[model samples]
Target: MNRQVERIFSQIDYLSSAPQADRYGLTKLKALRSEMERHRHEKYGLSEVISWAFRIKHALASQDHSDDWREGISWIGDPDASSVDRTLSYEYMRSDQKLVAGSIWNNYYPWIRRNGWSTIGSVHNSGMGAIATWILAVREVTKDSSQIVLLTTRLYFETRQLLQRLLFGTNVQVIECESDCEFLERIKEPTNSKVVAYLDSAEQSDSLSLFQRISSAPLPKPVVLVGWDNTLIPYWKNPVDSHTKLSAPLFLMRSLHKLDQLGLEVASAGLLTAASPAQLTPERARYLELLLSEVKNSMKVIGSTASPTTIRRLEAFRLPNADLAQDSNQAATAASDRFHDSISGVLPKYMEAVSYPHKVFVTIPLPGTNQESISKVMDQIVKQCTLSGLPVMRSPSVGYEFTSISSFLSESDTGDATRFLRVSPGGHDTDMIDEISQCFLSTVSNL
Candidate 1:
């Protein structure tokens, strides 16, 4: 085996020494070791390597089917599978919760019922935020018929450890698959419910089989493919790499585009992607602020006037705002109430009016109101959209406004009016509203 392969196998072997500490370690080692044994002679062959990886993955999976791991460490702290199964029965109440809550619980309770069959693929190593969001989304969407199955694969053991501890009642199926084919098969099973696959990686070619498998399968429910790497999709074929099989990136782009054509809007983190819905860390918020900065710059040239700069500054410089952090549940509740108020008050009039090509950024006026109140409102809205399989992402937050029309025009349009709105929310001519409406109508008429 090559030095890199050897190193990988060695690490896996070391982890196997403490099986309880590294439930996935044996699976990882089996794959690597099997690859080494098979490809010891081939100058150019990784098929054996791939098969070995699959073997180790299968071995680890077998362990999950039994109570052997209970003697080691509980990935999630509910004791046995029965404990997890029993909790779901009581947690998913149908008639009492809100729409978003019902939708989220419906997504997760199925996996919980099936002894946790969800297999989640995280492209980035630091994707705890997204994972956390999934947990919250699942908890809120459970139903009597909910039989959720969820799973995850990560490169870091530490991340898995942290996740097991922080996420309450997460008993999803998890296995380590080092190859693309394995990932495809895990998601290719038959089900009449929602099935999701998260494919985020820079090497799209490696996952070509994944896209093919997904495409071939006759799915009964919605399947979401989460993409993160911008470079994975190759727009045009290059003569040099043409011999390579169809790339995962290109395949995914094509697949998603096709799905979009079929009337399915792919969901993304949207404005609330900073950290998962459950935990928004300062470090993570700052990292997203940087990404949002770039997104804002891209918008300035062609897209809408989504002020990524202002949102980034707000999230980065001022997070866990003291006023907002007093009680997490309460903050979320208040935010929801205020958000409905804002949307009900705005959408009717706002929809009737013309708008510049900018995203709607609502900011709650801050006096006694905490920043979390506004953030929470936006968060709820974004999560709601995500659950319904809609795209509500890469949005920005503008400051508060006296009126919805002004907020819409101010964020999107450029001209004397833009400056006027920003500098004088009150002093602008009252006729500006009429002018704004006419301008918006004229633009839409052309479209």
Candidate 2:
């Protein structure tokens, strides 16, 4: 093993020896150690290295999953094994609860079901999966060519691109609607075609209002609301990096219920999967149990009540720049406010011409720089930040070049093909953000 890997393991051993070591932190450390061991000789690309670094940082920051380290380690040894080896020894365990079934069901499905809306079906996938599943569900519900309208903002370029790819050969007309009035008018227009509207709440701040409007509107067809609830700022509390919990299933279930109440036949999809049929060795089974337990524990820690009503109440108290501190709610809110203020104070210097739609993201367009030049600058900035122990994701532009909503949004249409640099705080505190800002300013000044 290299010195870096050895150093990480040593830190893990030291942290494990602590009187009250964080279980979650230890579990992540162990996992990272395993990953490093597996990929010791392999070379990692820039993206992979950045991803790994983020995972490591997150693992080191969280606690509460130490009990599952042994099981996780065992499963890591044979992840692809088809069945449990009896001779090797394993215990069978099952839960009617689908762990991957997003936070909506796990958190509030019971309440939602009690309200009269029943789940038709669900798919476990990412945001893209949710969109695809909804499209398929629409096709299944209405066995005729339909007009699919996507109500979304520029922030959801990746999602829009994915939707385009999925609906490429279909007869369905996928129209990207940014204006709420335009969407409402489109849905109101009488046609022989069934209209399926896909609304993304993740990218739009006024998503709840849009949802209310759509749910109340007298539309001829059902609206498939895409659950992008992962973008919620308050839920960014989990310290575990690679194990970011998926809550799309829960959102989908709730959305289905809500739309059903409005007399709409709705279907939903999320990033969580139903329980798999594959059997595991006793060790692996134990590991799986621990993993599920960790997720449940995380939900509790994050205060996920699962009920939409409760969630809405919680949303009322959400601070724009909440920190990852879990001890006292008051302290976290204070920290979050400070975090936001800190970034705001430093960002103006380098990001004078930037556009910030939300507190989490800042986008700056390089006036005269081409994509290649901007990319090089961004690579240097990322390397510097990573070296300084603060890694930020560097996206040249928010979305695909051809499918970019920049022109449609009229935000970055500077005549020249603009290359913009996007930055996020990524759970860092004031000092870290200041340091990063300084590094960014220095890099830009030099460039």
Candidate 3:
């Protein structure tokens, strides 16, 4: 049996062993089906679905003949499969051919559901994460070719430009609105341009008039209002005040920085090298170190260890922070303990003891949670990694909210919380960074 086919058969067996009625089982199957269909449709770049079809067929065959099932399964081996083997397993086919050949549509069907664009809440000194979030938000709102108007703070002019470059390229027209009145003039144009207003710098200034203008205008398309900085629109403030004035539906994202900055540093880690977990090996660690050394000074890596002891181990190798230290002596003594121990303590058991070839896994809570709170913590890690020039592999497990589960077995049989992992490599490939960052950020920015 082909090794790839054997692997699929293995997964089918693994999944089939579960009770058919299990929600998780169904979800896993659905996920697999979705992936297969995506590949078949060419929505995803690779055409691995052909091999997947073979695997599924082989699995069906095994199920049909018990003797072949056992004997065929027994033939599976090759623990460390080569990349070439994986890639060559599938040949390119036309999209229609792929769908038919891969047995898609028959089993898996996906649809487009209209989800409103996300609103970003905070835009302080926070860096790449904010920009990445904005880019994703822009991408979603502009999908139908809507025009976005940026209301930036003079203090954050550099940040604004940086964000524009990263998200929409340097040529993107960003009107720096100094006040509500100026924003009014730009939108007054008679053209039927789709309108998106951003409020980054003028959090303290009243947007009531601006909101009124938007509400009063017969917008040719949907209008989206994105605001950052909670202080601008305090929770105690009247939501009706803005809603009464605004013409379009109002969507607000609290804890803007955290909500906006998903997958910010994923690219700094590495690319998708393998579909399987990256084994932690000493040589891989050396390679990671090399990768870390190449990160720009402005960027940083944050490694979360499940074990606090491993954090201490990391601290042992930590370089001194000159800015935080009063003097060289103070810097050495104080900097060692200055790390937010509260943040470090949450490091999971797997994080601390895991070997080399670290794959960075990060998780985020459901959106509209305390984004600012988490953003502050993450920013620190990014800064530290950037300063140290160390590549931190992201673990997908980072963002899961843990909880205890009750079972029929016993209270003692409690298991860990279900979580998702976001894995990415750390290195200097600009194209890879662009891809990984865009993919990761796109997932959560809608939240």
Candidate with maximal TM-score: 2
Each candidate's clash count? 27, 12, 24
Per-model CA lDDT versus the true structure:
0.28, 0.36, 0.29
Question: Global CA lDDT of candidate 1, please?
Answer: 0.28
lDDT of 1 by residue, 15-119 (tens): 331324334332333243344555543321123333343333333333432444333222212223452232223222211111132222222212122322221
- Give the alpha carbon lDDT tens digit for every residue of 190-302 in model 3: 55444455544222235534544555544333233333322222222232322232333332322311111121211111100001012223533332333223221112222
> Model 1 compared with the native: what TM-score?
0.23
User: Which candidate model has the greater TM-score, 1 or 2?
Assistant: 2
TM match of model 2 to true structure: 0.49
My TM-score estimates for the predictions, one after another, are 0.23, 0.49, 0.27
Two-way TM-score contest, 1 vs 3, winner: 3
